[model samples]
Target: MYRYTEFDKSFVKSRAAQFRDQLERWQDGRLSEDAFRPLRLQNGWYVQRHAPMLRVAVPYGELSSAQLRVLARIARDYDDPDPDVYRVASAAQGKLGTERLPTHCAHFTTRTNVQFNWIPLEKSADVMDLLATVDMHGIQTSGNCIRNISCDERAGVAPDEVADPRPFAEIMRQWTTLHPEFAFLPRKFKIAITGASEDRAATAWHDVGLQLVRNETGELGFRVSAGGGMGRTPVIATLMREFLPWQHIMNYIEAIVRVYNRYGRRDNKYKARIKILVKAEGQRYIDDVDEEFRQIVEHDGAPHLITPAELERVRASFVPPALHASHASHASVDEAEANANGHPLFARWLQRNVAQHKDPALRIVTLSFKRLLQSPGDATADQLDIVADLADRFSAGEARVTHTQNVVLPWVRASELLALWQAAREAGFASANVQLLTDMIACPGGDFCALANARSLPVAQAITERYQDLDELDDIGEIDLHISGCINSCGHHHSGHIGVLGVDKDGREWYQITLGGSDGSATSGAPQPGKVIGPSFSAAEVPDAIEAILTTYRDAREHDERFIDTVRRVGLTPFKTSANAVRVNEEVSA
Candidate 1:
């Protein structure tokens, strides 16, 4: 994990204090809502459907136990909504036929940021103060700015890693944090970097995607892509540079974003994403960025080029933590294997939740946040604290928040896997469904987000409840089932093997289902949006529709083929027919 330096500590404290001042001014009427909106947004505070929501950045998904403890504290103390606000919000949800909305919980997003809803705007300053103490903040997490820089959760520890991307991601993070020139772009921008052979970070779905690569001569560089995004337009980023020297990454990215800032659409929010610009311009857009890069290097002297010493300094912070000399040795792998063979449930958990680590002695364990009862990605304050404790005890006092909206104990000793699994099971998150159908990605739809056309939680819950049998989930195999509240694609519905998108029809909630989407992982071929099966279906029909689709998949799939593979092989027609067959409302199609 990257530890904060004195300078880093000071800078975050200063920013937090700055936000407190702005908040006080807004509260005292010195700044009107119109004037204060941008300021608060820059600090990652947003007025959502019911109360203020705070998005706290966890850069590259890395967190120390202390930082996790602070987040837990925020969820516990400051996340309580005002009484009247809660009453109104609860009543609104009741009308939607949802169970009572959960509060005092933090949501782990697909981008690896932690979000807290129901926090009063007035207490935002207090929350900021608390975050600052742990060298955390929500800076640049919102508004039309360079949002958080995400990286692969297994950056340094993945067996297939070419080079760790964290140092470069950190370098970019520092450069983009408060860059005055690029602060207010036409739309929000996101960047994802991965150094591993497997595309674990979904780089191709970001505004700027970086893959660490080496040339034929073995010189380190990057494969750079730009314009990928999801929303009204789902685009796989265009490959801009096949091999950009690693040292020049920042300079090259500066040019790319500069080009976007110059010509990206500003009049219409729907078309403001760089993807729209890139799609419209194509070769011309690439040419513009090339020209900009030339000017930046020749005329402006490439001021952002990363130096070797600076790279080393940044890399030093990311070095794997050493095992303490006094720590007791854990059980051997042979013993764990023996235990697993005896306990079928333990074997199931191991198969789904544990991943290979670069170090054979260690393992990467994902704590399943997707289960029945709770909305996906949500962890109560108590749950958060339990995760923190687990991280400290099993993962060298560190953890990583995965892009799949789960927590990774990236340093768990292989021998201690059984004990850790048991602890997590007792904590209620060890469901052994890491990539199964029940381990779905879903947003807090109409339940929390004001932008939602329908509720996502109910749909997710219904499906989870329908598939409680472990044997059934394993039979379905690994799949990406993503649900988004609206076209915002917060839950990344566009990339799911089976995508359920909430839609508005008059005043009622309907869902548009898509099939054969991929997030560009080794298993999921390439980054591409799913195809819409047909007209939207009513919310009541979504679960049955899904059941029908799965049934169709089971019928059509080749031996041992995954759901996504089967969808690709036979195409969406069969699944589409199956899903639509269950739809009772013909009016939805009309």
Candidate 2:
């Protein structure tokens, strides 16, 4: 893990003090909520359902064992002390031990946002101290400012990658942190980098998605996609630069951000994301503007922000770990094969959840959170603590959170598979359903989110319950059912095998279904929604609609076809007819 330098520590300390002063002024009534809002947001504080929630940024979802320990300590000291507050109490107790009590702290990782949130605000200083110890500060994790620069979690480890993207991500992080020139944007701007063969970073859904690749001449370069985003109107990013040299990545990004800062919409917050700009003024104009800015910056070095040496310094912090050749042995392979059938329940898990590693004997173990009858993305604080401990014990003292909202123990030895699985089972994270239909992605709708038109979690639960048979799910093959509350697309419904979007129709909750959407490298287009379905039904009808769709797909699909492929071939008419058609017919008595 990268350690914070003296300069980094000073920056965080100064920012913390600034926030403390802001808090004092607000408490003294010198500043109102409207006045203090931006200051608090700059520090990662937000007003949530129950109380003020503070989001502590964990850059790129990478955490050292020391940082994890600090998190455990902070949870014990600051948040609510009840172990039973969340469902995974045993897991929490196992990780932090019985002596530690739960603080009100709850930890979560967003696909693109690296954040930690909790209620109450008394322990801000302690949290800042922990953060400063590492090379991290939550300077612009939130607010109407440029947010954290995200990259693929498996940047260096993935076998089919162009290069490690962490260095570039780190450089961008430093350059954008409290930058004066691009600090105040029309809306929050997000950037993602991916060096993986697969699009694990959700690159197509970001403001800037840089795909690392080699050009025709075998020189390292990037295929840049711009203005891609999710919200009311979802647009897959357009190709701005087909092939940009490696040396010009930062310079090019600076140019794009500069152009957006100058011409992006400022009149309406809803219309402010770069996607709208790209839509209103075609990609050609944006490209021309970007080229113009690039020339200007290259000539004058306008900001003089990051130099090649500075970037290399950041890159040096992310070198790959040394693995012993002897560790990759046939014995480890035999051990994995021995445990293959130890538990039939884990057969599918071992097959789908685990990722291939560079070392033949080692595998990147994925802790499956997609279990039956549980909230898709919800993990109790205790569950988090246990996973942290397991990472320390089995993996290489670190863990990576995936864009699919799951945790990955990137360096787990095959010999330790059974032990890790048992520990995970105790923690309630041993779901054994990673890519199955039960592994649904859903957003917190009317339950916790204020922006929802209808409830989504319950709908997800109903779908999971309907398809509880593991054998049936395996036979059905890979199907992604992503649900969103509204047009904001928080659950990434626009990219699901069977996308379901909740809508309000005449003051009643209804669902709009879409097919053929996918987010991986294999599939690269947004799925179109089918006809609007029935009035919001009791929980029972939700499952019925899903079953009808699945049955229709099964009947209509070609041999061994995936759901998205089938949808693409046959279209949504059959599924729509299945869902809306009457099952029982009236008897015609003569």
Candidate 3:
């Protein structure tokens, strides 16, 4: 992770003081709610249904164990002493453990950040002050500003990685942090970078998605896509440049954003994202962006090209960890191997949660927070402490938050896998359901969010509980079910293989399902956005509808084929027919 310098420290401290004063003014009635809304938003404070939600940016989803502990401490000191509603929800689901719960928890987000749902409005400044002590703050998390820059969680150590993307992501983070020009664009903007052969970061769905590529001549560059996003008018971003030289990345992004700022509609907030401008303008938009980029670099002196020394200074911070030679066996592995023969549970967990690391000796393990009877992305403060402990013991004292709402221990040794898995199990973080139906992606729906129409957490909880059978989950393998409470798409419902978007109908919650969506693969190119299956279903009808859809897929799929592949082979007609019979789970429950 990149450390903040003096300038960065000064900026956060200054902002916290400014916001603290502003908060006092708002509380004292010197500032109206209308006047104070933007100020609060700029500091990542949002008035929610029950309390304020504060989004804290975890840069590139990277966190040192110490920083994670700092977050846990903030929950302990600044958050409410007890949250009764969450307690009841957890108790019903058998998750109200003996460990003390924090007033609020750090909810891992789709952008690889964390959010707190129940922070009191009066204590928002104290939260910022705590975050500042650890060089963490919530700037750009809300409001019409460039949000956090995301990169692949397995950027450096993945087997198929083209390059380590963290350095470049850090560069962009520094450059865009407080850029005067981009702070007040037509709407909020997001950027993502992918460095591996697999598109785990869903690059094509961001305002600017950059895939690192090597040209025919073997020079490193980027395949840039612009204007891609999700909402009512979901649009896949278009390829803005086939091979943008790596040096001109900052300049090229500036050019595109400039075009968007100039032409994007501000008349209607609903139609304000860059996607609308790109769609409305089409080829003209692309042409204008290209022209602006050309003039900024060629016609104007190369003002934006970063010097080699400066680039090296940024890149040096992300040096790969020093790893020992492979070809060694430990008693830990011997013990695990001995247990593997009899312990089917550990074996199943290893098979599902572990992935091949670039170094043969190492393994990248995913620690699932999407446990049965719990919300998909919710984590207890106690779990946070346990994760930090595990990272210190198994990994190099580091962990990453994934876009799919899970945590990654990116550098575990193959020899230590079993020991780590056992620790995760004891701490209630191991689920052996990565990329499975039980591992759903969801938002903090109507329960906490002011923008939600339905309760996404309960829906996720119901689905996870219904599919608690490991055999059933394994049979229905590699399915991505994403749920969002509203059109904000915080759960990234647009990119799932099975997408669920919650809507309000006659003041009751209903869900609209979309099928055949993929975030796309670097191996396969740009992704396929989800297509609507049919009309919406009531909240109670969703689980059964899902079961029906799964049954249809099982009936039609070829041997060992994935759900996405099955959907592609047979379209949505079969799915629609089966899903319409939303009585399978209901009959079983009855």
**Best by the lDDT measure:** 1
lDDT of 3 at 332: 45
RMSD to the hidden true structure, all candidates: 2.3, 5.8, 3.8
| Candidate 1 weakest ten by summed lDDT | 324-333
Runs off by more than 4 Å, candidate 2: 72-109, 112-118, 121-137, 302-308, 322-326, 523-540, 582-590
lDDT of 1 by residue, 520-563 (tens): 99778888999999988877788889999999999998899999
**Could you estimate the TM-score for every candidate?**
0.97, 0.88, 0.93
Q: What clash pairs does model 3 have?
A: 228-237
Model 1 segments more than 4 A misplaced: 82-94, 324-331, 584-590
Candidate 3 residue-wise lDDT, 314-340, digit = tens: 878776555533554665446656776
Q: Give the Cα-based TM-score of candidate 3 against the true structure.
A: 0.93
lDDT (0 to 1) per candidate: 0.90, 0.70, 0.84
Best candidate according to TM-score: 1
Show how many residue pairs clash in every candidate, following the order shown.
0, 6, 1
